[model samples]
Target: MKKTFQYVDYLWDEAKAAELGDDQVALFLYRSNILGADLRITNYGGGNTSCKTIEKDPLTNEEVEVMWVKGSGGDIGTLTRKGIAGLYTERLRNLKNVYGGLEDEDRMVGLFNHCIYDLDSKAPSIDTPLHGLLPFKHIDHLHPDALIAVAAAKDSEQVTKEIWGDTMGWVPWQRPGFDLGLQLEKCLNENPGIRGIVLGSHGLFTWGDTSYECYVNSLEVIEMASEYIEKKIKENGEVFGGQKIEALPAEERKEKAAELMPLLRGLASSENQMIGHFTDSDTVLQYINSNDLERLAPMGTSCPDHFLRTKIQPLILTLDPSDEVIDTEATLKKLEPSFEQYREEYLQYYENHKHANSPAMRDPNPVIIIYPGVGMFSFAKNKQTTRVASEFYVNAINVMRGAEAISEYTSLPRQEAFDIEYWLLEEAKLQRMPAEKPLSRKVAIVTGAAGGIGKAIADKLVAEGANVVLTDISQENLEEALATYKRDEAAIALCDVTKEESIEKAYKEANLAFGGVDIVVHSAGLAISKSLPDTTLKDWELLQNVLVKGQFLMAQKGVEIMRKQGLGGDIVNIASKNGLVSGPNNVGYGTAKAAQQHMTRLLAAELGGDHIRVNTVNPDGVIVGSKIWEGDWAEGRAKAHGIKVEDLPAHYAKRNLLNEIILPEDIANGVFACVGILEKSTGNTINVDGGMANAFVR
Candidate 1:
């Protein structure tokens, strides 16, 4: 770690701090940014900073000493004034006198709530007492990988003495709580003139009267540890036999991930509901492909901080690097049994530690999966959690490697890890999460998702908490569409629906991304208006290839994967009003859509034995945001109605009995109703045309 403080930026922040009226908050924000900006110092949401200041109580009209700590659940990198919780310091310190010694963690939280200086302030961090008990005006706590590397070694105390001499204090492993706060206070009283304290198997804490002092103290300590590790590596050989192994090309690795990820996603999932994210970054690949991976990967988390995100041990799967190509089916056969074995081991671990009132064991599945020669696969209940687990595991790899360079890397004993894993403070966070949406844990595929109706369907599915795979013939449009929604929950695939190879590849990629598909919305179609006498063979063939043949291929492939998983699924085909009630110059488009509508009925009948439901959404006059109804198509429709092109929308709206202008969102609503709200009603057609009597089938 190099020093990242810039003199000019510091001066600018100082000047800006004076204008904010609260110098402590402004300085805290600045220093927190500087600390969080360096990944070497902290990973995502892993560190905290605080400042002690004075504020006037609105009700009392008197100045009160307060501690403004980083709020719980806020990331330090993007912290704002609202992200700091203000508490009455004198009152908060007085809680120790009234401590009943019952439900300490819960009582600590309640007492912190009672001591808030501002009623509207956010919740205080659980580690607030750790800062309040210290005498300094500013405090910094971080899980710097370098510090953890030194602190987690077998001879951690000796390493600490060598690196910091008498300037730092060492506290043994203790779960963060009121008790830990008391322990820290005792340590500070015993070790005079110490600049900071290193919490064994946890993190680093430093404090000062000014923000600059606290920030610089943390930097210097971490820098010293980094230098020590670097020297040890130079004296000894590379950590864990750091021999460079040749990796497959990037494209080949990506292909291998695509092939293997689906099987892992299926096997690692608890009840086939978990979503997976694959990562093959150079650092992760370097560690997983190393010769010592079998021994090192199973050695537990570098620190207890990660136990909440990642379990104690990662599941290791050995791969045959000699086989150049991946056979997905054969791989699944091997992984299926291994997944069962992992679950059994995990249950046994839980049984060994369970007491009368331990929290229910979190799904008995591994959060991190190590695939030798491939990379890492991180699994979670959703996409964001999966990404977080991946980040922590990456940091774990670095910390462990650094420790191996100096001494053998050892983690907290398994019992200590289990205690933290079941700690009520951590479990409460999960309990407070919002209820999942209707389609949570389900995966969907939306064809022709570049724009208009297809894009609308994808957005709606994501809003209801489904992982969607958006496919279109145009890559640019597909990417733009994905960017509009939750990007993590949506993926893009450039697919030409007219080709069998393209359709197959798209489904395979979707399976790799989110295990398998549970819903298919076939919205990719083309509308070409031509009279019977004027229609050519090429126009007819084009319509059939995309509108009719494409749906067949998509349904066939989607149902195959759904059947293999034995999960009931839904398929909705986007047809047209012209299919049921034909107008002049609608020979090609109408015939193809009519065939598609019949195909939906046939599929519903044939697949009902497997509990698969198929339906059709026939929407007419969806002129707004419709790419298919623009340019010549709009002009032609206007000509048929004896009106100007711009007035065609008004004319069509008036044509319906309800006189309502149908939008793409209206069509999306119908599709959503079919797949989600109307779960029991399938093998039916729902028309979204604002009551077109002529096209009514009932």
Candidate 2:
């Protein structure tokens, strides 16, 4: 008989499974992908899945039981065969004799090396023994919100029996270790014929004789729990004790979030700079707008992963967005002390629960901040980490809603949460992470980023580990250009530099996407080759708006953000050699270029006290991949030189000392040199025009 689900999708495709030809490991990978595809089932990089299969040993040439499980830090949704570690089940089980007790369970992690059946396997996880020691051929340990909702209920043990009856067993809260594996084994032995079990204040475990059966069982249990929770919630007829305050108007909400993100990011990054993510997502708004936000947020997250990513508790601000007008100054004043108190409390938390072997307390700042009328902001070391941290908190909110509707919600015990946070194994894992890149924790904003020089600069910045906001006047161009970069380290926002509102929207997007900009590159401009007589006021004004005024506005906004963040920044202007070596028919265009270069010097002089650097990169003839040269400008320039438009590149190259052509990539290199390499030099020009003597600045 086929089964249908209301809460979770029935994603098991038998025909697709048939394509695998019954290799247990291949089947395990397929099932793992399906389960992980839904956040309702498991969060990113959370949970564990394994299959114990009969395989032939290379040495013995005989059958042996081998366990293949998800390696540490692997996301099952994107897991490949290489991401799963293989171990000999007999070796895992043999460790039981040497295992001292719960106190010595962490040592077994080191012993996992001797059990390696696949020498090329990925690093093993703490849950390896939980899978290997179980009698079932296939096992799934998932953090489904519906199951966690029940597991995190105040009366979870009684609630588990009532919801699942005698079929699903229950074990009280215990950290993942060899000891918990034994407890699970004991539960299954005590209750014969049960299909699964729920770990209190944790997650769920369901197993089957076959991979397909295990997948189906997991779905059945989760969907059934969802249905029951929905019914009880309907009976209760209220959520989060009803809404405490109305959500601000949608547009107002975004503006409010934009205003708050940079300030909060500045406060949170006192110990180490951070990248931030903002969400007024339906789930987040629903939770924060409720009366229970203050009550429940302090209870902390139920899932260990959520708690670890979002921290033990979130910092909830008293700002009410529904007020007719908000006092920004008052909020700023409150934030200073709120941050101080949060750090002190976090330190106290560590001091209270830490053991002698615990690693030093990490950054005591809050990872999540909640505002009543606005939304949530989560900060971390990079863009992806911030995004994933926010998603984990959303999952926690879902668990809270479900648990509270049916019964009182429960968080992990304080000592247990602290133990998991300060675990020696976790410290080792953190120590194993690769060193950060030169531009790590920095965010850059690139105007004219759709194509040409702007895109090149954005790409280089991202390569050096900076998060980027790709801003351009054309939306269609921005989307097409952004798609090519193909990484989460970059974002796109449509912007018209001539307009202050457009520029504000771009900065808002940048602030929300990856905290605020630390580097600003002004690459958005156009060129015209009209002679002095041919240049009309309209032509003159167009150049000024895009070239001169655009930089003015962009710089104005960048300074505001950088000042608020209190982090020194960089502003690189992509000027032209025309600014220096003025010639025929260049009156309007050359004046604007000169203004741009001078503006760089003025800003550098003014901003130097704040440690902000301003520099310029001058390129004379960047014709290839150059949109500016594709039109009347190229025709006009070629006409002046008495050469065909096609000959412009060589014509300009011959004029330079190096006799070399300049590309957008050369301009991009200059920008990197200013921000990444020439750290001490500012108010200076780096000419990238193949050594143009006439354009050189002493």
Q: Which candidate has the highest TM-score of all?
A: 2
**Full-model lDDT, candidate 2:** 0.90
Candidate 1's residue-wise lDDT over 1-698, tens digit each? 23454211122254655665557788888888868777777766787889988788788999888898888877776788888898988888888887766356667777799889876677887888888888789999898887888778878888898889999999887877777777788889999889999888778999888877787777778877888888898998655676445567777766776666656666666564777777888878878877777787767885766767878889887566445334556666767777888899889989998767789987888889877666788888777777778888887887887788879788878777887788777678778878988888778999999999999998899998889999999998887887787547899888888898898889878866776788999999777876788788998999999999999999998887776555678999999998999688788889999999999999999999888899999999888898888666676667656789888788889999899999989888998898889978778999999989989988
Off by over 4 Å in 2: 322-330
lDDT of 2 by residue, 70-179 (tens): 99889888889999999999999999999999989788999998999999899999988888878898899999999999999998899888888999999998899998
User: How many clashing residue pairs, candidate 2?
Assistant: 0
Query: By summed lDDT, which 10 consecutive residues of candidate 2 come out lowest?
Result: 322-331
RMSD of each: 3.2, 1.7
Residue-pair clash count for candidate 1 = 0
Error of 2 at 587 (Å): 2.2
